[model samples]
Target: MNSIWVITKRELSSFFDSLTAYILLTVFLGLSGFFTWLYGSDIFFIGQATLQPFFSIAMWTLFFFIPALTMRMLAEEKRSGTIELLLTKSVNDWQVILGKFSACLALIAIALLLTLPYYITLSFIGPVDHGAVWTGYFGMLLMSMAYISIGLFASSITNNQIVAFLLALFVSVFFLIIFDVLAGNFTGSMGQFFNFLSISTHYESISRGVIDSKDLIYFLSISFFGLMLAETSLSKRNIVE
Candidate 1:
């Protein structure tokens, strides 16, 4: 517990010490805000008194940014041989994974926090669907968690941050795009199964303000599977060296 918090704090401090956190936050907030207000399918274009545009943009923003954020979790540590030192501490493999995962989530949370003004502005302008807004944020957070876990797993399997980033993005693409495309191409039960596998489907479902147990299960299953793979990778490395 305490060990996990220590690692979390360490990772957070490291993020701020470098320019990673600031850059990611700025890019995330900027892109999201821009698309939500100015350029793309913005609120003015939608004219629905909903935060759906922001939510849609956020989902895409996280697809790229979360991978970049998690690319260094273990990949950089292993590259610099700090992972060996890290393993020698009182912390266990899961704690390290959880710590890193929590740090990434915290950073995403901060970025999300910065977008609160979007909601506030929407409320001031017109009638806003509070339920949808809440669920939209929840959906994005869950989607981000799944991506973060996948990114951490990708980071664990490689020693290069670039490789980790690409691998994470590759794996995430299946859930984000490929599966959805494949799902549409298929028919009957097969199409239904593929649609079930797509993260976008579940995200869209939850973003509409309906929280289903199946959606929760879907996100949790991916997150848990990714974290388990990461823990396995770390444990193997620890055993080898």
Candidate 2:
């Protein structure tokens, strides 16, 4: 098999073999649907319907959920002594990383697809901006990539899944609303820095209606930085083992 497909198959199979995929889809769909319909009002304009209710709720939900999905990506491999075995195979560090990342992204994409009913409902109740909704979906995809990368990094740092989960959650959440969360306590440059660091700032800009290039760059950078950190940590592990 080719590199991408090789990782894709492994990750996809892993999700089905365990109950993780089912649990994530159910929880995400149920919660997001509730918030959108109960809170946003189907008939009323919901600021793109995909923004305030769908994308906004997704931000908070992904903060806790993505880590759970990814905490075991590498942590479990190491804890099981499988990391060493896998390393000895033809796959290099990046192949392993890409495979795992691709798998997680596929699962996330599936979860996003399951949320389509919300859009159908919006169409039924009133006219919705198809462009904005599409953009919001793109923003969610970017956020997923960024979160999964960070979660993978956290998992790489240790063999404990719970530790991996919490670490990823904290990092993702901090950046998710870093500025808004810290803004109230400080002012001026400090506040400016916090705002600059917040993931929400970039995500919100994209979710509004347009696919801004700068926002795309920020997500890609964070995702790259995250995966790079994970690869570095694994390299250290290889040397020690």
Q: Say which candidate scores most in lDDT.
A: 1
- Across 97-119, the per-residue lDDT of candidate 1 in tens digits comes to 99999999999999998899999
lDDT of 2 at 76: 94
Query: What would you estimate as the lDDT of candidate 2?
Result: 0.84
Candidate 2: tens digits of C-alpha lDDT, residues 6-68: 867987898999899999989988887777666654324444434356778888787788999
lDDT of model 1 at position 62: 96
Poorest 10 consecutive residues by lDDT, candidate 2: 42-51
> What total of clashing residue pairs does each candidate reach?
0, 0
Off by over 4 Å in 2: 40-51, 184-189
- Candidate 1's C-alpha runs over 4 A off are 238-241
